[model samples]
Target: MRRDNVSADTELEYNLRFFTQFIINPARTGAILPSSDKLCEFMTDLAGLGDVSTVIELGSGTGVITEKIMRKKAGSTTFFALEINPAFVDATKRKCPDAVVYQSSAENVMKHLEMHGESGCDRVISSLPWSTFNGETQQLILDSIYDVLKPGGVFLTYAYVLGVVAPASWRFKKKLYAKFDKVETSKIVWSNIPPAFIYICEKASR
Candidate 1:
């Protein structure tokens, strides 16, 4: 098969896998399809991965965003991913063979960081479904993210346009503003499925 045809077929396979996971566990597998390439590219670009020494990806579903991170990060970058679902973990590993994918929850990011002999990471790009998380779950994960980031670190995550109005999403937004020193939202990427926008946040440089 042609390279483009092969790529299209692989993406279709990933989409089916994502949708199946969502069907199996809607609460954990929040998105029905893998993130669009445009959304992933926009997020990684805004993250400024060129100089970062350490990076972590949270909730790397099927490795769509993870692939972008692998390609964009500097050669010296130390990167790993946290994913709770075993199937998704396997998928991520398959997609990014060199990726260190731990079958762990986002709340345990600190432990993983310690294993790599790092105090904190410079950038955190999350694909977690904040809109599907309950208040407590959201706060717990956010707290983990906040604590694992070094001062002046950047955090990036995106939300679907429709999900932005959800009560859970609103609460997530508020938490980002409250936790970070600066919070910025990007223009919607209409090419993405359901359309989405990114939230760029930075920890204070003390």
Candidate 2:
């Protein structure tokens, strides 16, 4: 079918673009391939996108997850994505023509929220490479996430199965437990390359 062909083409293009970005800056781009469909579906489901009002996605890569979020989010939901890589940003925009994909760092989410006349968002779904960031960089973005989310909001992100034993991943896990009122992990998505699991963190209600 035409749609299937388009999807296949998009996947190929994204894989090429993603790999290029990862080679250019491994620390920032992280993965050599964009997330798989199963991974994207699992993340959006965990976010409870149907109920959220304002949603923000960090590190949208080639918009694989961004496309999923767009499909799952409520009709009235205010959604936008932040991606620091210009090539990734462009790819995301091209893949998701109507999405508000901003070429900015994850730490700058607040400015975009302010632009929307919102003090906070109901959900923050991130695809950021936590293991690649230094302690300071991790804390800076985590702090920004905590500050920008409404009380009782959900923050969802994923960690690669292979990276679980890494020290930086452990540090990021501890930080999540310390920052959020509750932290939970999803079952591993074995179909994905290298496999991955989601982290669902909730802020305490006021």
Per-prediction TM-score, please?
0.95, 0.96
Where's the lowest-lDDT run of ten residues in candidate 2?
A: 1-10
What does candidate 1's lDDT look like per residue over 1-206, in tens digits? 11222377787787789899999999898888888878888999999998889999999988988888898898889999999999999989878888899999999999999999999999999989898888899899999999999999999998999888888989999988988899999999998887999999999989
- RMSD of each candidate? 2.0, 1.7
Q: Residue-wise lDDT of candidate 2 within 1-206, one digit each (tens)?
A: 12232477767777898998888999888898888888998899888889889999999998888888888898899999999989989998988898998999999999999998889999999989999999999999999999999999999999999998999999999999998999999999999987999999999999
Candidate 1 residue pairs in backbone clash: none
Query: Once model 1 is optimally superposed onto the true structure by TM-score, how far is the C-alpha of residue 189 displaced, in angstroms?
Result: 0.8
In terms of TM-score, which candidate is strongest? 2
Cα displacement (angstroms), candidate 1, residue 187, comes to 1.1
